[model samples]
Target: MEDENDCISSDEEDQLDFLLGEEFGEDDDAELYSPPNVDTLSSQDTCSSQSSQSISDPLERHIYWKDDNTEDNGNVDLRTTPFKPTRQPGFQTTNFTRRQLQHLKTPLHFLNLFMTVEFLTTLCIATNHQANYLINTGKYSSYTDNGVWEAVTTDELLRFFGIIIYMSVVKLSALEKYWSTNVLYDHCPVNDVMTKKRFQAILCFIQVTSPGDIDKGQDCLEFK
Candidate 1:
């Protein structure tokens, strides 16, 4: 009777082990097959909340994230103020007389708009002043064959500038070549305007402002 009781106890232990193993295996299978827990909010609810948030926040509504092609359905408030022009558009010449309009037909008239007669006269006076200053200081002694330096006139200065512009367009190997009597350079009109000596004289003493006018230890343009 004792051996039969021992055998029954062993059978009960075996049945318990089998049941526990089946339960553990089922738990592992359930874990592997179960879906992930997601938020209870529906797609419509999430989209509506985002749209409302974007509408509330002005900065967020306009934020364009890189690689994000999604667009919000909320209406964007753009500045719609009508543009009232203060002045009439297009080139309409104002404050010009009929005589001035006739003068505008010449290219020199346009050039003089920037380089006015008063400005040219000032430059001519400055150039002459600088030349006389250099002569009085004995600085003009170095130039060979430079006879009594004549004062530069506004008309002569204008012609000088015209010659300079012409020279820039027609390049030459040497500066003197422009005035050369060589048949190759006979077509060049630089010498016809002014002699090379006069050009050199003007170039050497071209000054915008007198050196004496400038204060000591101050820049030329600086006000005292």
Candidate 2:
């Protein structure tokens, strides 16, 4: 009787093992990483088959490996090589002269600094300086107004506008290949935008100037 009961117990155990194999598959390898976060996985039955195969398959055992389970793990760094941009012909000198083209293609972020300075100078000349009548007449001695205050204002305005035009048209893009707004932060360490802009203008004067090609007067704008 005991021998018959032992046989029954063994049969029940084998049945349980067969049932587990059907449910989970043969290999029994637990995936370390979650599946890709995509909506298509909901309908996909690929993982179910995979799990079953992993649980039941004796030939395919789970091996401990890193995130990328490559057979040759040491050479993995070669996967991410940095890509350099190819230099295009005439990309640097289409608009500006050779002197103006030195650092022209360096980077857009640097070019933006000079562009901003030019814009600000133009704004000051076109908007703020236009209202001054006195400085204008003073600049032209023959057209001097009777009011001394008006003449003084006009003279200041003219000089101011002249400087602005020089900065905007000439010095901003001519002398340097790249411009940096970072200097503004260096001069005034405040977080205020207005103060930084003021420092940028001041630094522009310090850095930008006429090129040594004095013979090309038409090509260069004079700045004092």
Candidate 3:
């Protein structure tokens, strides 16, 4: 009886050990098969790496032609390809009004003549400064010398010629009327004395034409 009891106790101990072993196996399987949150971190890292790589390469941001298979590599014909500039668009073309165009033609003609004369004279004067100085001074002299002001006379002569030509060529209609008016006969605002004399004459005409006048000139003014 003592030996049989001891055998039964040993069997119970073996079954307990087998059950513990099975429980530990199940725990290890759960740990291995059930993944942790580290996979989320790895996915985020992969996306960040792709974004950084794209940022490092400028060509990745620019537009590129693709083939039917979505391949980016292609031949670029720079001559035939039109490129849009990265700038603001400007005004569209427009035509001038007829009246404005006609008025502009006269000013443009005068401006062209002025510019041509000014450009040519300036070029000649700049290139021949030394010659001009000698001719004006009547001798060889340094430009910075005491009496070198004589060289400036040559420039004055050139300016005088330009002014005379401009005045002779350019004219307005008002100048003719101004010359035709006689200050002695007409009352002039600029000629204050003549204006006063004309005013006195008008007063005399008024006095002579008064109601009680018995004069011939008074009668003539009355008729007037």
The per-model lDDT (C-alpha) reads 0.65, 0.38, 0.38
For candidate 3, write residues 18-101 as lDDT tens digits: 435544664433211111222222243454445334433332222233345764355554542458876657722245456644
Q: Which pairs of residues collide in model 1?
A: none
Most accurate candidate by TM-score:
1
* Per-residue accuracy of model 2 over 3-63 as CA lDDT, tens digit each: 5423223333343465456357664443322223322223335543354345434312321
> Cα deviation of 184 in candidate 2 (Å)?
18
Query: Candidate 2's error at 215, in angstroms?
Result: 42
Instruction: Name the TM-score of candidate 3.
Output: 0.18
Off by over 4 Å in 1: 1-92, 142-147, 221-224
Which scores higher on TM-score, 1 or 2? 1
RMSD per model, one decimal = 24.6, 20.7, 37.3
Per-residue alpha-carbon lDDT of model 1 for 24-85, expressed as tens digits? 66443321111122121122244444543433343233222333364645543243123567
Q: What is the lDDT of residue 70 in candidate 3?
A: 61
